[model samples]
Target chain A: MFLKLNEIGDKIAIAASGGKDSTVLAHIMKLLNERYLNRKIFFHWLLQRYDYGLDLFLLSIDEGISGYRDDSLETVKRNQLEYQLPLKILSYKDLYDWSMDDIVKEIGRKNNCTFCGVFRRQALDRGAVMLGVDQIVTGHNADDIAETVLMNILRGDIARLQRCTFIKTKSEETIPRSKPFKYTYEKEIVMYAYFKKLDYFSTECIYSPNAYRGHARVFLKDLEAIRPSTILDIIHSGEAFETSAESNPTNVTVPGVCNRCGYMSSRDLCKACLLLEGLNRGLPKLGIGNTEKLRKKHLDEKEKSIGEYSSSKRTPGNPFIQNFNDLKLGSDLKKPL
Target chain B: MKINLEFSGGLELLFDGLKQTSVVVEDSSLKNLFKKIESELITQNKELFLKDEKLRPGILVLINESDWELEGQYDYQLKDEDTIVLISTLHGG
Candidate 1:
């Protein structure tokens, strides 16, 4: 299934969460690279060879959620030595100035996962940049993909549903991310990790008690119990639908650099930047659903001072200078205008 | 029957964060073994690992390094010093 590894570049970061899927993936990739790529073989075998002269790193994100991410990161650090791979750690505190704990305290637990998820996605990219890796590989397996497909279908998110089944995904601006375990089963992964006695961290996030994705996962697990093939079937169905990433008229969000952090984004500000602004300014809701109005508000305020607002332009918002009460949402903050 | 049981991939979280345990049982069936483990080991969230008198859907059971499905799932007889492994495949990545 991973004969495609031959195409991967010289250096890549495995987005390991110290989970079963990634632990197995890391071991398998290293095994294949050593056994297959180092030898001179026949033409057919060469095509199947996985050697890309790859430099491997374990990239882990610390959401600073205390017991959860910190515990998991310890396992990642152990694997750094166990797997003979270097490790990189990026924290939400450094990236966005808010840990999941702090975000939860402000936003309330209801929507903090959204902040963590969005920030973690870009944090991986930024961590890759710091590590000097051009490609990022995650341990997303068949079950994960299927659950995402179901969730996207439930939410009527066609663009994301169509893209969820892809083995490799990259926007025009960000580093490429791939999932080699796309065809592997969660059962097989755990089994392999167990029989091999690989170390991993598995406690659920303390604050993730009521995530909507949890429902999708339970539904998918039930379906797998009845028929194991259902997971792959959902992925195949997802792949059957076609949604153009570029020309989707309804969701005209195209890739651009964030006006705040200069990271890849589809809007003036990336989700991380917007969420950071919300956290620092005490308006965590500003980063959640329907951010369009808040984004326009930022631009309009900028326009009043400069007399002209620029689209396709980057605005440098002051995250520290604006001050209100420590937890105040809107007033007395010395607004940008 | 004396058995060696191991739980992992967060399944251990149900067993008070224990990854491995050894127990002696008077009854030898896998079902009784599960009940014994539940009564003796499971500290909390019993339902996360068991449902409707069966192991939960996402937990994989292995006996002596082979899938329990190959060796008669819950009916497999436990032997002295037999190794049983239960791994949960349910957590997010």
Candidate 2:
């Protein structure tokens, strides 16, 4: 599925979560790159358009979920040594001044998934930036893409329903992220990991009682049990959707930079910034489900905070550290300011 | 009947962090082997592994490295040294 590997830069980072999919993916990527170099390209088109020079790095995020992330980072580190790749680890505590454990305390487990998911997305991009790698590959497989497609449909999120099926996702400010195993099945990944004896970590977050996705996944698995092709069919149907400016003119907003952190965002403040603002201000519910209220509240808050910060010459409303300069990650965890 | 059972994708956490175990069971089918494994093998988080007398939806079963679907699913007759791999795809990627 990632046939365009030749187009990527020499330095690429694999967003390794140390799960079965990622462990298998890290090994497969190395295998493919080596095959391409040894004149054993998998396809005729690859022989014409392939290059053999790519440096791989293993990048992981520590969500600070006590046993979950802490255990997984160990697997990632092991994979780094096994794969002979460099490793970089980032944490929510240092990046956002809050961990999943702390967030679950402030907000219940109900909406903590939203916080963890959004924060992890932005954190990956920022971590890639720190590593100076613009290309990132994740382990999202056919099952994941299909589940996300169903979730978007269930949520009536036309924007993401259209975007989730894409093999590669990118914005102006963020790294260009691709999924090498986009068309690969979950069973294939698990089997590969098993046969190769690749070491990985697997444990549910102690606090992630994510009901919505869990339900969707169970429903999809039932369908898959009846007909294994249902997973691919859902992904194909998602790709069949066509959402353009003419189709949804007013609903779609042009992507722009987040005024607070200057990250690529459809709104003035990205979801991460809004969520972070809510957490730091002790209003953890501000960015939870149905963001219309958060959008309106953020507008007023942003303007007022921008004005306040323009005079103080500091970051607008961010509570962790004034700016990235004041923040340090990777070595020691940062405490909330 | 002798069977080789391997658990992964966090399901092993419920099985005392044991990924691989060789068990001798009374029955020769996966349906019966599951009951044996659940009752004797799993000490904690039994609900995570089963619901309504069936393996949970997000969990996958493979026979000899092939999809269970290709191997007759839960009804596949077991043989000596058969490897039944159980993995959960529900964990966060």
Q: Give the best candidate by TM-score.
A: 2
lDDT of 1 by residue, A55-150 (tens): 778888889988888888888888888888877787777555567888888888888788988988977876777777778988998888998999
The stretch of ten residues in a row with the least summed lDDT in candidate 1 chain A is A322-331
lDDT of 2 by residue, A1-337 (tens): 2366436346788999988888898998888777776663556566556645577788899998987788888888888888898888888887777889999888877878888999888878777766777589999999899989999999888878878988887455566888888899887787677678888777767887678778888899899879979999999999999887766653467878676666677877678888877887787787877878766866585677754542346543454433433223333334443
Instruction: Give every collision pair in model 1.
Output: none
Best by DockQ: 1
Q: Give the fraction of true interface contacts kept by model 1.
A: 0.60
Q: Which lDDT value does model 2 have at A323?
A: 40
Model 1 misplaced stretches (Cα beyond 4 Å): A1-9, A41-50, A244-252, A297-299, A302-337
User: Candidate 2, clashing residue pairs?
Assistant: none
Give each prediction's root-mean-square deviation over alpha carbons: 6.6, 3.7
The chain A TM-scores for the candidates, taken one by one, are 0.84, 0.87
Model 1 lDDT on a 0 to 1 scale: 0.75
